[model samples]
Target: MTIRISRRRLLTTAAATSIGVLAMPYLSRAADRPQITHGVQSGDVGADGGVVWARADRPSHMMVEVATTESFSHAKVLPPIAALPESDFTAKMLLENLPAGQETFYRVRFRDLAHPAISSEPAIGRFRTAPADRRDVSFVWGGDVAGQGWGINPDDGGMVTFATMRRHRPDFLLHSGDTIYADGVIAAEVKLADGKVWKNVTIPEKAKVAETLDEFRAAHKYNFLDDNVRAFNAEVPIFVQWDDHEVTNNWSASKQLPAAYKERSIGLLAARSARAFHEMYPMRESLAEPGRIYRTLHYGPHLDVFMLDERSYRGANGENQQTAYGPESYFLGPDQLAWLKRGLLNSRATWKVIASDMPLSIIVYDDAANRSGSEAFAQGDGPPRGRELEIADILRFIKSAGIVNTVWLTADVHYAAAHYYNPDKAQFQDFEPFWEFVAGPLHAGTFGPNQLDNTFGPEVKFIKAPGQGQQNLPPSAGMQFFGHVRIEGATGQMTVTLRDRADVALWSTTLDPRPGKPG
Candidate 1:
């Protein structure tokens, strides 16, 4: 419950002060006596700046610093930063005015002022700046890496997925949701006498919190403890947002959770979770503001990425007719809907990618009693709220506005699948062709086993579940994999490739947005 740094290693009051203020004696070198337990982490990279972070194994509060160069040998280390008692012993430092489309290295050392406190060997990694002009760029993003368990094979799951993505060398990583399973429950693997099996169980300790602030903090630390998860983070710059699991599954804005929020005294559960989310992820100010996680990033004029917040503005589940299936009745709230509409309408990019935590489309088994699957299990009242955003209306809006170059990238369905949405539902409206691509579980287990058939084995359209050809693990609905989206800004062409941890390209597809025409 507490994080402490020992003062025994204090630099001679005058010795450490000289590090940046003045030249200190050649106290020590990182390689000579390294004390870092985890590797380095960098995030929030923009044309102007980014964050450099790391943790130490020894007890010490030292200053954290960074340099624009991959080797700190000739770079400047900023002021010494002491670790706050609240965050255990982790240190996150901001580096400003970093060069674009380049690499940076950072170091962490403790104070005792007497020595360098055996700094951790610095980590060097590369990142790309938002294209300043129309040029090609590529990136990857997906979320909900809850822990692994059940009959799952660790070697063949999330860890493998991270290895797959590492091969792509994306500019940044966008984590959509459920970065950690805060509820902390797993399947019981046994059938209850009442004929109800506990497919998911919420841990009692995490459930007993009076305020969600501490609860969410606990969840973050749990995620950082995973080795494979930490490695994926070390390699890429991460832009993140919260989904249901970070707090509670399927939480809509202001929607109450009787078992959890009902006991909280301070701020709403959503607010508490949001704070914890930002504190843990090195996300920039764009998504840091409350109720405004929606924002647009333009990779030159080649691609315009719109990250949306669907659950917050969503209408409660159930059969309540009257309004058109969009905007006013959108899964995206008022502010977000408007922003998205304007962003889409104004985009001149070759490709428009909408990053959403929930699938724009997924199976919604109506009828509450017979309902199953993850989303249904997390809904409120009536038959499962199957596709409430009025899939029809949203698609129409995209077409009507001439937002021709658009594609949706999403996770959370637990299974990786690709499909095109027809504004014209095949059953009714003429199908308007818009495509969607999905990937998953960076360092979390493959989707919790499917209820009836235990379908981790891929029978659907997708590639081999990583290593399955060489070693093999159960196939997954969304086989633990990461998404690699490569776009040629010049040609307005996009190529998507999915890879397993073994660096094998599993599945891929291409899309071409020719001015205002469909691909």
Candidate 2:
């Protein structure tokens, strides 16, 4: 389990002397090279600063050096942070006093406490601080990873979509959900249709469903094994939220797992998954309560990003009838919904983006034999029901408060599409019109153009799914998708583009703010 740092050809006596007495006491000349298994990452960028993350193969003190320039000449080294086993030896340091709207370069190295000079190879990363004022803002977002037996293959470019995404150079990436497939296993090879074989690099922990805390932690670590993902994380800051696969398929807080997971309680599994998630990403802590992931980030005066937590407080997936609307169906819970409403009403940004983990109007079905039910907002075809009642209440509040230019961005269905929900054609028409854009399955199997429940008067404007007679295309085939948004500072307009793995634009549209005009 030790990660050896790659050794240099030589360490001259003069260079060792330059390190001085502070370094001599802990230097281990006989120690082998220490490695950084997972590369460095940065996230939670603010106007002044952000957080940088790294993991070492062994117990060590993580040191992050920050600078305005690429070289170490002007660098300021942060105090050493312990990479403890409590967090699976991962460590993150909050960077401060950085200039606004400027790119900051950082590098991480691990120092073995017993042999301090025996350090891991330095891993370099960069991210831009949030703008001090209104300026053009751009970001990319998608979800679902290493699912349906798809794992990284070195021969086929190792999650190449991530490399494609890195080229866009967005300010950050919002991972909508399904950060890992903890509920599924990865085999050495998967047999697809037409007798074609998709190969993968399988590890012992990922060869079965995650049950123990260590297993869940391993699931999150497995994603970092891809070089493309590591390179992408090194450059672009990420805002992440979780979906069901982090625990199990279509899971809710109240639902019990099938017999296969009978040994471990759902609560226990979720706790482990949440801890692993926080350790792996540099997300800001929730102020309302500890272990909460939903939070808001303001990107200058042009955009406000609200990341949601759908799995934490939701009701069971099968309780989708109209009768379940009041007490039995709880999505986002009461506190989070209230926070979202208040935040939206008070936000003065030109565009308020709800980084939802799942789409609103789509009907997500469970695979139970005797029961028919849905996940997400819409339960019936014509009107607000079940969890949709919660969404309806939020939308109604926004319209009553005259909040304008609110849009929803999500990706749980593993397809890409654009839908316009206009109350002009709806049964429950108390809300203002808005748009919801969906995209995803970053490097997993690609499936479906999901059916839309018309409760919110959703009209599909554009969609890109698998061609006829095909479903769940492998990542190697280049069918993965991601969405990008660019907001114009001067005009306050937003353009959203959906692109395939090759970085070719599939669909693009410009949206202008429309004042609230309730029906």
Candidate 3:
């Protein structure tokens, strides 16, 4: 039950040293040795296994060693895997047969392919495996990093919200989409609304919109340049999903080529972005459906997170007002919706958390300037139309199957709020009452308190956003937010709290699990 981390490997040193730098190869003590660039990360952890990821500066072999102690006494060395040019020098390997409910420490180093004797300095990472039995569980959820031209600003503390979240020391982070803003360019400096200068640490790859495969890869890598993000990744595992920004803003099958993009084919850009997304994160691969983002992660007896991908399969974005189940109504798509229902029915956990990338009732515009076209599920406030049909179906299915304790957590609209969906007040009232919590803009522009649609009758309980006539406010405005959730083992009650970058709780509510639901 005792776990510890070395002083040098912990967060303080990482925070003080690695700010806004790419951990480039040439900066290494020995230029010929392969460097462990971008540090290390762990993800998709469960009772028995997890995925370990790291990137190297050159073609090398990634070697990993696992241990239960900080001193690495009796550490077990795993087989080495090759990191080649095909994957952009990034590699991840599944670590199996880990003990449940215990802290696991792993060390990663890259050995030069040309000279096996030469190896880079080891990067350390730690994560606690999911409990085999009922126990207290806690985690953080948020997303939207480096979005809306807000890149790493070292002068402004280099994405300090990540450091704030890391202080909580959650078991993992449920990153609800917008992992990177591939379409958003990052300049060296930006002029804020207050006439103050916001300095950014920019690279050539992030200077323009991502078009080529390498550009997409670089976009993902750009986030790691922030020391806070890298330190957070080393300590906590991440369960990640992608939304529109991973490819482009409001991207769909019918997206028009923008003036900034030289590569006209949206399909090609999407393909490259998907490849880079899979390469960058430490998510488990789906053999059945390769590059699939939607999957279930069983954290323990108390929690099961259902990660959804709302971007990959969908119709074109427009005025989403379809009245029936069709291409335009496909939000989760048919396959993913079925998988979610099946997973919910099969789950035995106390809390069934639907980790959606987009909120249900918040009206996100595909064309924000014109304020027309639906980017999310809510198409005005009337009935369950367009993409809302798919969500309504899922909600109805959850109710009919008597699945209790179902909650939705999302982070796409760049703000934080709480909504209570009541069937009695709804236009479509088949679903049972539930709670949907929203939080985000982990380190991006803060813009909402968006208009809510009453299709499923969502009543806003609380909201925090920019003032009227204000939008895309910088993180320096102190509006950045994230959600923290904890489930008590003995009581089976889940508490959700919305907090800002300063780690101050803005609002919170505790929900008791439904009766007769197995804990």
Task: Compare the candidates by lDDT and give the number of the best one.
Answer: 3
Residue pairs that clash (backbone atoms under 3 angstroms), model 3: none
lDDT of each residue in 67-186, candidate 1, tens digit only: 445555444445565544455445666555544454555555554322453444444444455655656677887776644332223433434455556656777787777777755444
TM-scores for all candidates: the values are 0.72, 0.92, 0.94
**What C-alpha root-mean-square deviation, in Å, does candidate 3 show against the real structure?**
6.4
What Cα-based lDDT does every candidate model obtain? Answer: 0.55, 0.82, 0.88
Q: Write the per-residue lDDT of candidate 3 for residues 1-519, one digit (tens) a residue.
A: 001223233322232233211132432467767888898999999887689899999988887777789887556666578899999999898876677898989989898888776788889999999998888999999989999999999889999999999999999999999999999999988998789999999999998899999999999889999999999999999999999999999998889978999999999999999999999999988979989999999999999999999988888898878887898768889999999999999999889999999999998998888998888888998888899899889999998888999999999999999999999999999999999999999999999778888899999998999888899999898899999999998998999999999999999999999964452
Flag the better candidate by TM-score, 1 or 3. 3
Q: What ordering of candidates by lDDT runs from best to worst?
A: 3, 2, 1
lDDT of 2 by residue, 1-519 (tens): 112111121111233333342243333452464568889888888776777888887888887666678875445555578887888888887766566798889878888866776776678999999987878999999999998989987767888889988998999999999999998888998887868888898899998889888888899889999989999999999988999999888777556687777555788888888888888888766556977889888777888899899889887776566644545678888888989988887787889999999999877776535436666776767777778889889889888888999999999888899999999888789998999999887989888876787778899999988876788788877889999999988888899999989998999999987644452
User: Which runs in model 3 stand beyond 4 Å of their true positions?
Assistant: 1-29, 517-519
Instruction: Give me the candidate number with maximum TM-score.
Output: 3
Error of 1 at 81 (Å): 5.4
Q: Cα lDDT for residue 160, model 1?
A: 46
